[model samples]
Target chain A: MPASAPWSAAVGQGGGVLRSVDIGALELEAGGELPTVTLAFECWGVLNAAGTNAVLIQHALTGSTHVSRGDSEEDGWWEGLVGPGEVIDTDKYFVVAANMLGGCYGTTGPSSIAADGAPYGSRFPLVTIRDSVVAEARLADRLGITSWHAVIGGSMGGARALEWAVTFPERVRRCAVVASCAASTAEQIAFSQAQVLAIRQDPHFAGGDYYDGAAPTSGLGLARRIAHITYRSETEMEQRFGRAAQDGENPLHLGRLRPVVGGSFAGRYQVESYLDHQARKLVSRFDANSYIVITEALMSHDVTRGRGTLTQALTRTEGVQFLVAAVSSDRLYFPSQSQELAAALPGDVKVHNIDSAIGHDGFLTEVGTVGDLLRESFFAQ
Target chain B: MPASAPWSAAVGQGGGVLRSVDIGALELEAGGELPTVTLAFECWGVLNAAGTNAVLIQHALTGSTHVSRGDSEEDGWWEGLVGPGEVIDTDKYFVVAANMLGGCYGTTGPSSIAADGAPYGSRFPLVTIRDSVVAEARLADRLGITSWHAVIGGSMGGARALEWAVTFPERVRRCAVVASCAASTAEQIAFSQAQVLAIRQDPHFAGGDYYDGAAPTSGLGLARRIAHITYRSETEMEQRFGRAAQDGENPLHLGRLRPVVGGSFAGRYQVESYLDHQARKLVSRFDANSYIVITEALMSHDVTRGRGTLTQALTRTEGVQFLVAAVSSDRLYFPSQSQELAAALPGDVKVHNIDSAIGHDGFLTEVGTVGDLLRESFFAQ
Candidate 1:
């Protein structure tokens, strides 16, 4: 048996508790050994007598395990969709959300202390989507969830949901992969690679070993700015910011003459201000090494890596009911990619369209539409 | 008359001569003055007694004045389209190409010497499309060309070409604006802003005055990488590079352990290698400050700025014939934008489409299609 340790459970007002479980050493897909993998998770409601009513919700890159506000009064990322009387109906179904490996939210990531008492830092092993799912399965085993009633996620979270179903087909009854593809496309990888380079290029980065020094906030901010552009659609930007200068600031001659670093000239365009705000927010809460780690993991996400063709890779998932969805304006993961994933599935799976001008983030923003789909398909009585 | 000086013209074998002409001190639209404005230009064929046969060609951002292999044995960018018997027919219409203001290729830009005998560097004034056209007009005066048979260009060059006709309606008899728009969209500005930030964040950038020290090659490379992604279509990137690792470079386990800067792991993806090559090439030949200057100029590309609507902006060009074209797969400047431009013109200018899978670069790559349009319309004499 794997060495297991159950840490303190911080119970919240809604009976949701945040917990961490040690799954011991894990051998990564590519190479290297993670001596001890600790997964931090949060759960709501109780398991049924048969222990088959459990549902796993995967979080996207840079997301934490706080899927909904349970103990904490702070609003969760997906608060409305997973509440007591909401679509997922937390009171009825046992819900579990885990901060993915390589994340900094109480998980055993690069920032986590190693056996030798130093932070893993640059020494952290390369982890893939499959590896994270494997770690999640260990957590599932400890919780006595033999088979999940459903698994759902969007964006990189959607990728994890699909991986769970494919890696352990018998463990998942139904899977909803929203606004994601079966694999990371070339364009997707290209964008992710650029982000990685942005952080690594920062002099303060110091080969990811800057735990005691000044954080690479500038590089992280730059990376966030780049990613934020991809998350939203062109039409949305055009409608919202449309070449308008930021209030009380002119991005013209005087602005150009000023240096950008500490000067007020950076926020010339309203769109630049929006991007700057996004970058600042992410830098404040997120870790740069975690960003790079998760980004690289997402880059290594191809469900068909060693499993032949996409059809062949998904052959094991014949028993799983699938819900594939795409945002209409998502330039990152195009709708056609979702169609390709659906077409490659074992059975006749139809791709649900979430009509949104918000681009890739629509899966997260269009909660009403997503909740409706989940209620009608996976959670209906 | 402008205080003009004809610098020595370097005549190439194909009879193309590279020359610089002083257009004197000029007032800028953005509250500054360029004490002395010199424009670098190149010419092919010969001017007739009428001088109306002179056809002005505008180059895009980072593009040089060498439109064809004239005296230079090196292959010009648009070599096949403008030789003795080609589409533009240099032999028939005295073809002249000028490197715009704020360019590095022998033109007065940020790298040029100021009145104090030092590089303009960060002190370079903000220049707009109208400003460049005004400077080009003085060059036209020196060449004794009263009217241009046609002013043609693509991408940023297209913006310059359109500005010429609108700014000096009677000087240009015909104009072709290809793969461009009347204004830079919000998304375009967002992307350009990210690139500008990337350069400024570089430790070596030193507020755009790094001429005496190591140049911001890394930051410039990052900027180029960002811009290059926007230049190509997603389908093309997928078809060409599709998750394929570079030869002998595994982007998996071992690659992840390696650091990015000066590390072999950076070129794991074939697409990354391609981008790296592109960045390297641009860094070798182009100045970082020039890139920023031209980019900002493009960002300030609203023809309807001081002018009323787009229709009002083109009101002065009622006498000039217009040819508007768009790349079918262009995502940067959408075809709809080209249609909007064509619709706002005085005449019924049909938006001709250059069907190609290459995306925004199609305007430059699909020479045959562009040449066909020019031959049929602007150069059909």
Candidate 2:
């Protein structure tokens, strides 16, 4: 580990291009090896002469590496924060974002080909957040980045960002863990298990190797529906949908069977219809096997795993500038969790509050507040 | 609606025994009609000379008429609350508990036979909580009871108790609605929808008509698992099983395929294992079709459905003694909702708090607290 690496060989290979590279094998923490690991990433700006201006940004579960559109026509998820003049300022910093190890994007996951040249599917080894961080580290090494100016992320991405600081303290100058905790709580694990079971119970799942035939769309849809409800606040759902019936249809009449226009009473509440839309959208864009793999990895997230304690695990990143925040009304990851994470950190860290009525999804929706916090805490210097 | 029917034909026919009788047809509030409605009820103690000492106890979802061990040897779910010397005091007053209309417990529900001699199955009409209360009223009429001394219920049962006070204020002297809200909140509806969809998504569901073949036990199990999480507190889950793996099995290694004693790597976290046990127990004893029907009916619960406002709906129960209480840690029905229901009542009705860490299930688990409250309020009289 060096203080900085300048004039490295892999500096300008991907200046601002969305590209995929073989990061090779990943030795998992749970005693297993992924024969081949491919990471899909996007890079922006150029590595400075000192290489200290490089920044790493991680995506949350189901999120891709497209942090901002440099060459792609589609807009990124965090478009507000990673543009040229935005808080992340890709024009001034060499910014990089990678899809997690078990992601469905271009990353090597359950959908990817195994050593036998067939889809790994159910045979894909269990991956943890630490394993994904390790894979990303190898990618970081190739890109000639010795130390990052800031590693920014929220939710699961925040977990990864925090791991980067702990696992490689000298390599991460600043860490911003927003809307996440140091470890997955029991409630979080409980919800995740339900989602996993939802997929497993589907007949079409075929042990997660349904690629040769009909995909387990129904199971994946149900998983998404469950997750979507947790993502948004209950107050927001009530205020938005209320007791209103779906457009021109009444859920009141949705019995087991009745003589209706569709020959079945499939009408739903407005809120149910909204969840259906989300499920349908995810089914079209994501892989069911990958969703399960990534979700399990997230469930295995424990910053203190194999470490002495929460304080001990976090103690590795002693003097790193920390910016932790939480969504005020988030039931999934409460503000109290962020407060706990902040208190455990060995620094004068205060958990910033993102005041939004949208629950856990507030971190993504209320980007202006997140952007402001980032600019003040890490970017200002 | 007579003042009394002491010599009614249905009286003393069952005589403190678990019995079923046809209550005839029911016209639903939403629409349509049930051709014939059968109610299964259990009575304990005597009706008294004046028939004024009768107590009506409504059971929650999945609950049967067996509130205590009287005619049956099996112990009841609320054995502590409804025993001979308990707060409810079955020895001093007549106590009656009925299975909900759409329930599987000997009641005419989705599992009942239709005119075609086949199971109602998918053809079962939509039922509301009000519809259930209406059917129970007919049963009360047959039992030679003009008015109930007090109506006691919790959870969905609480909704029924509140409905009794509103629909027939003259018939209910005291109403104890514990751990339930006046209306189903958006969050409640959202969670309920997920559970319903879980069952419906099962390939074996066969559009809710799988009685002739394999039942949708997997789907029903998943639904129960989801609902079970909402029933208990996050703190309780953490304290009981905080990322602890199941006995002799590590959830971290629970991949798609691995040679183990369990035959697969589906080993779960301790919390997940607990949920699996709950799901399995419900599947063995309950009907999936009935589960869906009752759940939908619960989602349709709103005391002020057609009524103008909360004040208007509750105004019907003027002069009724209302005892409103909530589980302090309840996530499903917040204490604030109980406060709202109490505020809408005509008199000064304050929401009593059941101080327990059990969450929404507190009303069922903390029997001593509820017993004390009942003795202090309605039962003592």
Candidate 3:
């Protein structure tokens, strides 16, 4: 059995009761060995006698393990779907949401001290999505979860859930991959590359070992700005900010201001301010090193790396049921990709659509819709 | 009359016979005064005795006045459309393409030296798309041309063409706006803000005055990468680089490499390399400060600003013939925006669609289709 401990999130109070365990060393898919491996998770309710009532929920990129507020004061990211009498109903099923490996939320990651007593920093080995899933399986074993009643996730989390169904088919009885695909598309990798470069290009990054110095907050902020644009839809941005200037500033009237020594770049548009706010929020809480590591892991998300073709890899889950869904307006992971994933699965699986103008983030924002679908489909089984 | 001179392009020999004239200082739209303004232009063929056979072709952002090769040995950006026997037949009409006022190609911009013998840098006053059109009008006055046979452009160039039809409707007999909108949308502004921030955040940028030092190449590169992604379709990216590692390097296998001082961020995917190559090419031939100036001008693109609603703004062009077109797969400038522009126009305007899988770039890549449409519509008229 693994030893358990308590920890809080980088920002808000971590929802529910947080627990963690050192899952021992991990052999990474990219060749290096992670000397130490720890998984931080949050659970609600109790496991049934048979332990088949356990449901594993994976969090998206930059997300925490908090699914719904339990004993903690913080409101969960998915507050509408995982509580008592809710879709994933913690009242009956044991809900487990673990912060993926390489995550910073109470998890052992790049920010964690290595065996050499120094932060992994630039020395942290690249961890793939498959490697993260393998580490999570060890955590599942330690938790006495021989098999899960359901595995559910969206976005990066959905990639994890799909990996769970393929890597350890017997462990996941049912899977719901929402607003995600079986593999990271080239476009996804391109975006990820830019985000990673944004963080790394910061002067203060100091080769990723800036623990004792100023963190690469600017780079982190820029990365978040790039990412926040992708998360929301163009329609939403148009309706929200339009070409309107911020309350007191005018993007068109910047010339009247006195030029400062460093070139005063004032007069931000409302949308620019919105992006700045997002960047500032992320920089305050998230670790830059952890961000790069996690982003790289996400970029390495391919279910059929060494598992032959996509169909052959998915054949392992022939008996497992799936509830695949895609956000209608998701530009990041298009609905067509979801259709492809669904067609590759056993039987005639249809991709459920979450109709929203919220883009790729609909899986998190349209909680009621997600809850309804889960309640009627995967959870119903 | 303006004085004509000779100047070679920073890239290849500028297409056609390049010429320039000092248009003098002018008042800016954003409440400022430019002390000096010069417009660089290239002319092909000859103006008819009446001077009514002159056609103005505007170039997109990062594009030069060189539309089609004539006296110069270099290939032109629109060689397919404005050749001797092409749609806009250089043999039959005087084809004129001008570098925008804030462009780097022999045009007055942030890179231009002020009266103080120092580059404008960040101290350069903001120039709008309208201001550029005003400067171009001065150029027209000096060239003894009263009206254009037709004004045509795509993307930023398209934005310029729309401005010409509205700002000086009497001067443009026919106009073609391709893959562009009358105003900069919130989404466009948001993307522009990110690109601006990317440059400003660069440590080497030095408040936009990095001419004497190492320029913010990385920042400019990041901005280009971001912009290039939006320029093409997701399908194209998938078809082109799909998860395949770059030649001799695997993005997923970076961990086995030695943990060098700067984290040896060496292993790049093929897509990343492609972006890097694009960045390098631009850095070699383009000025970073000029890029910011032109980008800001494009972001400030709004034909309706201070001119009433979109329909009211377009009223000036009631009698002018229009050939509006949109790239079918363009995400940056959606077909809906083209539809909006077409519907708001005075006549029964139909937005010609340039069908291609290349997205917004189809306006540039689908030359045959664009040519056919121009020949069938406004040019034919």
Q: Model 1, B94-158: lDDT tens per residue?
A: 78889989999988999999999989988988888889999999888887788999999999999
- Could you tell me the TM-score of chain A in candidate 2? 0.94
Span of ten consecutive residues with least summed lDDT in model 3 chain A: A2-11
Instruction: Give the alpha carbon lDDT tens digit for every residue of A7-114 in model 1.
Output: 112233264456788889999888887999999998887666566878899998888888888767777778787768888886787788998999999888989999
- lDDT of model 2 at residue A247? 89
TM-score, A chain, model 1: 0.95
- Which candidate ranks first by TM-score, i.e. highest? 1
Q: lDDT score, residue A278, model 1?
A: 95
**The candidate that achieves the highest lDDT relative to the unseen native structure:** 1
Clashing pairs in 2: none
Candidate 3 positional error at B332, Å: 0.4
Query: What's the CA error at residue A314 for candidate 2, in Å?
Result: 1.5
Error of 3 at B372 (Å): 1.3
Per-residue C-alpha lDDT of model 3 across residues A19-40, encoded as one tens digit per residue: 8888899998888889888899
Q: How would you encode candidate 2's per-residue C-alpha lDDT over B1-381 as one tens digit per residue?
A: 243544322444223457777899999877889999999988877676577788888888778888777756787777777767778886677888889988898889999999899998888989988899999999888777778999999999999999989999999999999999888877787788888878887888988788899989889999998999999998999999988888977777735333334223455788878888998899999999889888888888889988989999999899689899999999888898899899999989999999999799998888889889989999875
Q: What is the TM-score of chain B alone in each candidate?
A: 0.95, 0.94, 0.93
